[model samples]
Target: MTPDEVIAAWDQPGATASIHPTRGISEGAYWASGEAQAALLAQDIPAGSRVMDFGCGDGRVAIPLRALGYDVTGVDASPNMLAALNRHAPDLATFRSDGSDFGKHLGRRKFDAVYCLAVLIHHSHETGQQLVERLRAVVRKGGILVLDWPVADEPAETNAWIGVTTWSRDQQDQITKRLGLTRLDVDRPWAVYQA
Candidate 1:
């Protein structure tokens, strides 16, 4: 499936997922990680650097980044998620649109970092690859791309429980390499990348 096809399939109950408080899904923990991720990304981008929080769900990173004094624009496909963000991070810039299409929604604007965690797993390999490219365009060359997702031994086209799709580690690595990304690390519950 194409990138649009992959996300399009996830339009149903795909937005529903269990939140792990001890990990990224938890509000506090997620915020702390966002700070850490921001710090790592800050090493590459300046304080006023603009960040495109692609697939930003419930303002996990957007709220923190906005607090850290970074110009952030959070984008997500789920209206429910966007609503939560609208309530939590009202001051932050937000665009309700598909993560794979940030380039168009935001125009030719380029960001210093594209922080997308727990988002890419919703797409199949094809869509996931396209998303990587789209996000690359969303960021300026040499920009940071912080991301994380669930990894499985086998890739799948559909997850009925979540009403989404996903790619395996191998698939993800291959696409990242193809996109000329430099993988910083890949430990469970956390992954970092830069372009």
Candidate 2:
């Protein structure tokens, strides 16, 4: 799906699963999963660091990360999602974008770390790569990026909005090299890399 299509699907009512699979189980489970993700991120992200929660759907992980002492700015493509986040966390800084135009929202600022979860898999490889490059541009040199990009034995790109896209090991490796991302040895579900 293109970024606009992904945004449309997520903005629709009853599309909670597109934002998070755990939402289909229970509200408690969904929020708990976000807490778990925040906890994992806290393990690596330094306290008081400026962080960007890319694809921050309704401040799920972003809220908990703020509680953990990180200065988090939420960014998302969907206006409804940002509005929902505003209702939930009115004080948290947020930017509306389809994984582009950071400077328009943030000016010349840069983040210490960025985490993108449940976002990239919905896009095509070329679009995902473009998004990644744009994300990398907003981070300072040596800043960390915790991404949900996955690799599978048999790589595939899902056509559905909520489908998972997996890359081959070689494909991942090549992108890592091209992006100048050094893979980190981290005990986390998402791929950790340093720019």
Best by TM-score: 2
* Residues 50-149 of candidate 1: C-alpha lDDT, one tens digit per residue: 8888877777667776777888888877677777788886777888777645656777888888877766665565666677778877777787777665
Models 1 onward score TM values of 0.73, 0.95
Displacement of residue 71 (Cα, Å) in model 1 is 1.1
How far residue 23's Cα lies from its native spot in candidate 2, in Å, is 1.8
Off by over 4 Å in 2: none
Error in Å for residue 31 of model 1: 6.1
Candidate 2's error at 1, in angstroms? 1.6
| Residues 12-67, model 2: lDDT tens digits | 99675556778888988888988999999988887899999999989899998998
**Model 1 segments more than 4 A misplaced:** 1-46, 156-158, 161-169, 185-188
Q: Which candidate is the best by lDDT?
A: 2
Model 2 error, position 109 (Å): 1.5
Steric clash pairs (candidate 1): 3-127
Report lDDT (Cα) of residue 22, candidate 1: 41
Each prediction's RMSD to truth:
4.2, 1.3
